[model samples]
Target: MIYREYGQTGKKLSVVGFGGMRFGPDEDYGAQVVQRANSLGINYFDTAPFYCNDRSEDIFGKAFKNMPGQYYVSTKSNVGKESTADQVRWRIENSLKRMGIDKINFFHMWCIMDLNQYDRVMAKGGPYEGALKAKEEGLIDHLVFSTHCKGSDIRKIIEDDVFEGVLLGYNVVNHAFRQEGVQAALENKLGIVTMNPLGGGLIPQHQDYFSLLKEREDETVSQAALRFNAAQEGITVVLAGMGTIEEVEENVKIVDHPLTVSKEKVQEIRSKITESMDMLCTACGYCNKCPQKINIPTYMEAYNLSILKDDQETKHRLNWLREQEKIKEDDAKTDACVACGICEELCTQKLPIIERLKEMSLKY
Candidate 1:
């Protein structure tokens, strides 16, 4: 695997870091996947307490036992607003125990979504203090954070200059909106680890739309996505959650080479991606204040899957979204849009909200 300098830490991390979130029901298969990844020279493994129903750490501990100090292990804590310093410390100790490691190479403050979350972390006796204490105690080497905030807010957070690195979602599709965050992380000399580089499997399922990014005949859409992120100016690692050995092998092949799409090529493919969609939503959250409180962007994404792709997995996302919502038997959802066209009035894209919700109503 190709390696890059992890910011100012002076450590080399594999470009294709193995995300330990998708390990399977079978323990042996999980180990085999990790073993295959290690064989392929993927030296960075990232996991979190919330992944795979909290079993990732336990599996990683066993899978990584025989090869101590051979890999850079990273994990996160989801502790937040309500957590005390004692709970924060317990989270670190528990993660160490679960990973069966004396020291965590990278221990993150977990998913800090906004400036409010940042304030909470910096509060007296908060998780940030706990993480710092752990670092001083030799339990962790670096402090990091992951965020789902938009690029502009992310830039604001990175300007604090507190973290050694950051984990954020920056995929081929949303890079235009997220590039600012990546720029800020780079400006601060913080290592950037990109998650969802494939837009959560969107590129692979809709390969025809991403054909402009395929640099070589042998390059898969997945490879193009990984290379796209790794080729960026400041990206230290492109994290992929591989569930199978085949996935490990395929990703390793892509990371073995440093071929990346140029800025011209990226713009070319991005235009294609934008043009191929019937009614795209950039998910800017403009429609979030709906009278029904509907998650319009998510539904739009599901609608994009239904309209743009031919795969069963992508089509099934509608059902996944349905089951993910929490509502009373008669509560409002996509079907409750009421065709007021209010969201369209505010949408920068001017997406036909009522029409798309009608499509979803008919389909789902």
Candidate 2:
């Protein structure tokens, strides 16, 4: 496995870190996947409280018991969920207990959506203060943040000089969206870990559309997408959510091969990212806060089919979601959107969410 210094942290982390959010229902299988990644030299394992129905940390604890080598654990606390120092401290202890670890290698102020939320996290007795107290008590080794904020907003957060690292949603499709933040992290010598390197399965699911990312005939679109993120200038880790042993092994193979992709090829791919591609939703769920209680991400994900194919496909996708009960009866439909524009404001990709909702309203 290829390792890089996580900024100035003095610890060399595997370039392909294991994201623990995608584990299946079988916790034993999840534990096996974690152990396999560790055995293959994946030393950085990241989880959060509610990932995998709140079983993610417990799975990591299960795997850590018999881990063959050393590894680092990263977990998080949401400011909206646990806003105070005491609450955060209790969360830290709970995470430590769940993971069976003494000290958290990296603890994040989780999911800052904007500068306003960032300020809330950094308020005198808020989540950041709680993390700081945990760090002082040696419960957390490094204080980092995970965000869905824009690149400029990220630059502002980094300038505060409080976080030792950052976890942001970055991928081949939306690299330009977060480039400024990546550059700022590099400039400040802070650890940079990128999530959604596969666009949350968008790239892989539509491999024909993303075929431009592949440099070699043998490389799958998934590998090409992963390589694109790993080859970027400031990315310290290309975090992939590996659910099975096969996924773990495939991700690790990228590290075994050359990590470099020609800059011209990268630019070629970048230049081809159309307006529709830019609007494609990765289903990150930042827009789930709709006051109308609409399932924005689900609709946007269905909308992705319209971008890739046609409105008929989008309708079919929505039908499937409805049949599967992903869109519940109480959830507001697209027509219910009040043009309040909250989803667009919270969107990390800065997508034209209201416009798209109107389009969906008309079509369906």
Candidate 3:
């Protein structure tokens, strides 16, 4: 496995970091998966409190008890949830207890959606103060942030010199949207970790469409996607959510050989991504905070079929979701959206969610 310096922190991190979000119901299995990743030279693991039905930290705790080698664990406290200093300190203590770790290697001010939210996080007696206190107290090693703001806003945040690293949704499909953020991190010599390296499962699900990303014949579309992110100049880690040993092994293979994707090849792949492809919903679930409790992710996922295939395929998907009981009759429909615009405000992709809901209401 290849390692990169995490900013100026003096820590070398594995290029492929384990994201502890997609664990299955079996905690033992999750622990096994994490151990396998560590055994295979994965040294960086990221998890959060509510991941995997709140069992992610427990699984990591189990694995850490018998970890095969040295590792670094990254976790988060959502500023929106734990806004104040006291609340954040409690969150840090709770996370440490859950993970059975004395200190968090990286603790993020999680999910700042825009400059307004960033200001709130940095306000006096706010989340940043709490995290700063934790760092001074030796509870965390480095301070970082995970964000969904645009490249410009990200650049503004980086300019503050408050964080050692930045984690954001970056992938082969959405690189253009976040390119400014990546460049800023590089310029400032900040550690850059990219989440959603698979476009939130979109690229692999439609491998044929994204086949252009593969630089070699043996590379699966997923590996190609992982390689695309790891090959970038500024990316310190390519974070992939691994639930099983197989997934861990598959992702680790991208680092087996040297990542040799050229700027020309990257540009070629970027050119092939059509405008409609840009519109595909990554299903990050940021839009789930709808005031009317509308299932925006599900609807947008179904709408992806309208872009990728046809309206018939979209309707079929909605029907399947209904029959599978993922969408219930009692759930609020798209029409129920009051156009409060909250979902659009929180959306990482800055999609026209209100417009999409209006369109879905009439058509679906």
lDDT on C-alpha atoms for all candidate structures: 0.78, 0.90, 0.90
By TM-score, rank the candidates, best first.
Answer: 2, 3, 1
Writing each residue's lDDT as its tens digit, candidate 3 over 239-295 gives 999998999989999987778797778668766664435466789898798879899
Candidate 1 lDDT over residue span 86-121, tens digit each: 778888899899878899998877877667877888
Residue 40 displacement in candidate 1 (angstroms): 1.4
lDDT of 2 by residue, 88-167 (tens): 99999999999999999999999999999999999998888888988998999999999988888999999999999999
lDDT of 3 at 208: 76
Off by over 4 Å in 2: 274-277, 319-333
- Lowest-scoring 10 consecutive residues by lDDT in candidate 3? 270-279
List ranges where model 3 is wrong by over 4 Å: 274-278, 322-340, 358-364
TM-score per candidate: 0.83, 0.94, 0.92
lDDT of 3: 0.90
Which is better, 1 or 3, measured by lDDT? 3
